[model samples]
Target: MLEKIFKWILTIVGFALGYAATEIAKNWGFINSIIGTSNIYRIGFISIAIILFGIIFYIVSPFIIKLIFKLTGFLESGIQKIPTNDIILSVLGLIIGLLIANLLITPFARFLAGNTILSIVGSTLTLVVNIVFATLGVNITLKKKDDLYNVFTFLRRFSKDKKSKADSKLGISQPKILDTSVIIDGRILDILKTGFLEGPIMIPSFVLEELRHIADSSDNLKRARGRRGLDILNLMQKELMLPIEVVERDFENIQEVDSKLLKLCQIYNGKIITNDFNLNKVAEVQGVPVLNINELANAVKPIVIPGEEMNIHIIKDGKEAGQGVAYLDDGTMIVVEGGRRHVGEVVDVVVTSVLQTAAGRMIFAKLKSAS
Candidate 1:
């Protein structure tokens, strides 16, 4: 059934081609002498041409279909490698180039009056001009695709200010891009309530996808974390003063979620909000702005200097013999030297040295009695 449809389609195409070929032949001296002022012979010749071409094409339709499929697959693969922005730029370039080519062809199009050879040459030149300009347009647009993209993005930012786009206006702050890890951490909700951070928080669709996958995870721990993240997002949307902007932009060619997040930061001029230490370091190295929730938590914790005395309950033994480990309310680890014997008891301790580390803040101290 499908084969017959394809054959007829190709046969129709062949008929059109035959008509086009006859029109071109009519421009030549040989064709005019053969069908000179004779309407009946012209119709007969055209019908014969159409029927002959249709039969030939119908017989070769299978090969044509195979070639078309091959060409389509090749084009699909090639186009898949190219970014959507580049394709738009290429099209824009082609239009501009064709326009220029048409303007340039105007003089020659009129000058070549009647001479067949000169007219053919002129037509060939016009074709060459259009092809050259079209190629140039595609090349130039592609070459400056980034600049053009930036310009368009800038325009869109203004045009879509009140829309679901980012609120990165002239005085407004860059949108804070939320990642899955930070969402799961859930401390950002408290921070949002404090109003210390700027407005216009954005959650990318890819990050949301990861969060959903985590929520749907088979493992209990992961599923809980994912559900907690979703819950936090829901709370933010319902309670927060600033409406959460869910960005649907995504990089199709990028496989890694982190890489896509970083790319999005660059594209939208947004800062990533994540508690993942590794991701924070990667963003720093890439010069992409990142707001680390862990960093913020550590910063807001009580600052204790050396010689400051504080009370803590010793919970466990530290690595060193007779060293005791305790935690402050904010979860800062306090190591009390020579207080291992006092484990499971609360005691006053004097800070000896405070150390700031990537993981968090750690304090070294001695038992107040020993001090």
Candidate 2:
């Protein structure tokens, strides 16, 4: 039914155009003089030409409209994806551009009133003005997109502060990646409760795999540690309800877990949280910043400087002869010179020096002389 209606419309349009062409030719007189040989031939020729042009236009019209609509939809989607703030600014800029074009070109158009040269120059200027406005609109739109993102970020932060979890606001800051050892040790929960650690806690997929491996290990201790790590991870995800993201990005090229963790840190602009001393050293050598739980524990321990006397009970012999080994409250190893005899005995020692490395800090001391 619709197709029939369309065909009727096209036929009417063709006849109307044919009639108009006949009138135009008669008024112009050139076609009339040539075809005055026969009225029927003149009418037939004009009618056929108009009918052919109308049929051609009608056949191609739907496809042309379809292409136009497709292009418009695509452009609309692309424009929508641009930040809202940018869109608003660009639209405003476009309006300003049209106003400026009108103001500057109107006088030229008036001055060129009757001369063909002036008319050509005026038309060219008008085309340039339109092109300039279009180019400025697109440029402004793209440039303001970043500003739109920043505005949304700020609004989100502001809205977050208005709700509950006011004390937990620190979780919204920079992210900190958690490793298997630190999760298993489980001191981070206590640390987080005190509100010292801020930002999102990221657990990489490889770390989860490591925990799973440990959980499945034949060795009882390793299995227990692995299970414990999994439990801590669940607690963080469910109970403590802290912000956590499991980054699934895996390194097919790197096999080592520590290496993958370092790479993850570099990718996320975050620091790795681990307790492995060797891993800590390796991270330092690779220029990846690490937030070693053990290091943090040591830094917070009581500071003992040179000349400070402390009584330590040495339990074993050190690597060197006549040296005894003791430990601080935070598990920092203290090497006492000339104190092998003091093994298993608590004796006052004077701290002589402190040594710090990527692994940890060490204190070197000598037995205090009896006064």
TM-score for every candidate vs. truth? 0.66, 0.46
- In candidate 1, the residue pairs with backbone N, CA or C atoms under 3 Å apart (3 or more residues apart, or in different chains) clash, namely none
Writing each residue's lDDT as its tens digit, candidate 1 over 151-218 gives 76567555554643434444667789998888998889999998988868999999999999999999
- State candidate 2's TM-score: 0.46
**Top TM-score: which candidate number?**
1
Q: lDDT of each prediction vs. the true structure? A: 0.87, 0.78
Error of 1 at 233 (Å): 1.1
| Regions of candidate 1 where Cα sits further than 4 Å from its true position | 1-83, 95-116, 136-170
lDDT of 2 by residue, 1-371 (tens): 65556556766676677667667777776776777779688768787878876776577656655676689899999976764445676776687677777788888888886899889988898879877976776676567755754565456446544632653474445579988889999998888767787768898998898899999999999999999989888777775655889998786657998888976775565778888888889877755668878768867877778999998989889999999999977788999998788889998999999998766789999999732
Candidate 2 lDDT for residue 12:
67
- For all candidates, the clash counts are 0, 0
Ten-residue region with minimum lDDT total, candidate 2: 163-172
